[model samples]
Target: MNQTIDTILNHRSIRKFKPEPLKQEHLALILDAARSSSTSSYLMAYTMIGVTDPEKKSALASISNQSYIKDNGHFVLFCGDYHRHMLKADEKEKETLAYNVQSTEYFMIATVDATIAAQNMTLAAESLGIGACYIGSIKRDLDLVNDLFQLPEHVVPLFGLALGYPDEQQEIKPKLPKEAVYFENTYKDDEAHMAALDQFDQTIETYYRTRSTNQREDSWTKQMIKTLHNRRNDRLTPFVKEKKFNNR
Candidate 1:
């Protein structure tokens, strides 16, 4: 495989990082790569905040319950932002139908933009031999995160990314087989799909058993089922509404 594809396939979440900081040049390049990602209709609805203050990082770590959030060489919060667009439209005396924070479509576009940008940054970091982990647990306390970042209306912290030099090694996790996820012309949930899922469960179980860290003898299906049974993120809708993203 080519270098790009090889890097993509070898991706792993690095939880433990060395105390060293990233060079300014590398950080700039990574941010540039993130901004190069595709933006929905060029709205570029994503905004990235690099957190460096010790007290702020400590608070964020508490909110995420992940010490790495504070210890990483760099912690970046990615936000789905539409406030900039709205302000620009107002200045131009232009009507913005899509800038309505309550519109689900607009919200989705902003989310897509943020997610794409984050992935681009992830790939760029990995290519530069930097280790990175996506701290999605920040979503557990969306209100606190919003308050900490002073997010205005039409802005939401989607996730935080922790990046630094690796202090530990980890095995690359397995993913479901292509047949189980990819569809051809139409969607199908027949015996073939079931068979692929069953096979993938075994594959996942083996990976968990043999992984270098946090080894557990559980299949992907079982883990997902248990997680789903907990009914997570019940507060997410309310938080969004509180942010005045009232459009459905």
Candidate 2:
């Protein structure tokens, strides 16, 4: 494989990081890679907030309940933002675009745009020998995040990316079989999918039992069951609506 593919294949989430901050040049390169990502119709409805203040990082770590948020060399919150687009329209004397901006379509567009940019940033950081971890817990309390960042309407924090030099190296976790995910022209039958998962469950169980860190006796389906059962984020829809998105 080429160097790019090798980099992509070796991707791992690095939780423990060194105390030193990222170099300014590396940070610039990562942010530039994020900006270079493709956007929907070139709207580029996303904003990245690089958190450097010790107090602010502490607050975010408290909010996320993950000390790595504060301990990392750098933390960046990626936001789905349409506020700038609205400002642009207003500047051009086009006030009628509010309805489209409030539509669920636009909200999805912004979310996708932010996600794409974040992946680009992650790859760039990894290629430069930096470690990174994604913090989805930023959505745990949107209201507090909004107040902490003083986010205006039509802008919502989606997730965060914590980057730093690696303090610990982790094994690359296994993924589902290609047959379970990739289909030629149509999705595989449910029975075949379950069979594939059933076989893969053995591999996952072995992985969990044999991994050096946090070894546990569990299968992917069991973990998925617990995850799905505990997936209760009632604040998400209300918070999104409060940000004036998806009303239509």
The global C-alpha lDDT for each of the candidates, from Candidate 1 onward, is 0.87, 0.91
lDDT of 2 by residue, 152-245 (tens): 9889999999999999989999999987887788877888788889988999999999999899999999999999999899999989998988
Instruction: Output the worst ten-in-a-row residue range by lDDT, candidate 2.
Output: 88-97
Off by over 4 Å in 2: 91-95
lDDT of 1 at 238: 87
lDDT score of residue 127 within candidate 2: 96
Residue by residue across 39-102, what tens digits does model 1's lDDT show?
A: 8899898899999988989998998788999898898999988777777565444345443556
Clashes of 2: 0
Scanning candidate 1 in windows of ten residues, the lowest lDDT window is 90-99
Alpha-carbon shift of residue 224 in model 2 (angstroms): 0.5
Checking candidate 1 for backbone clashes, the offending pairs are 102-247
Candidate 2's TM-score: 0.96
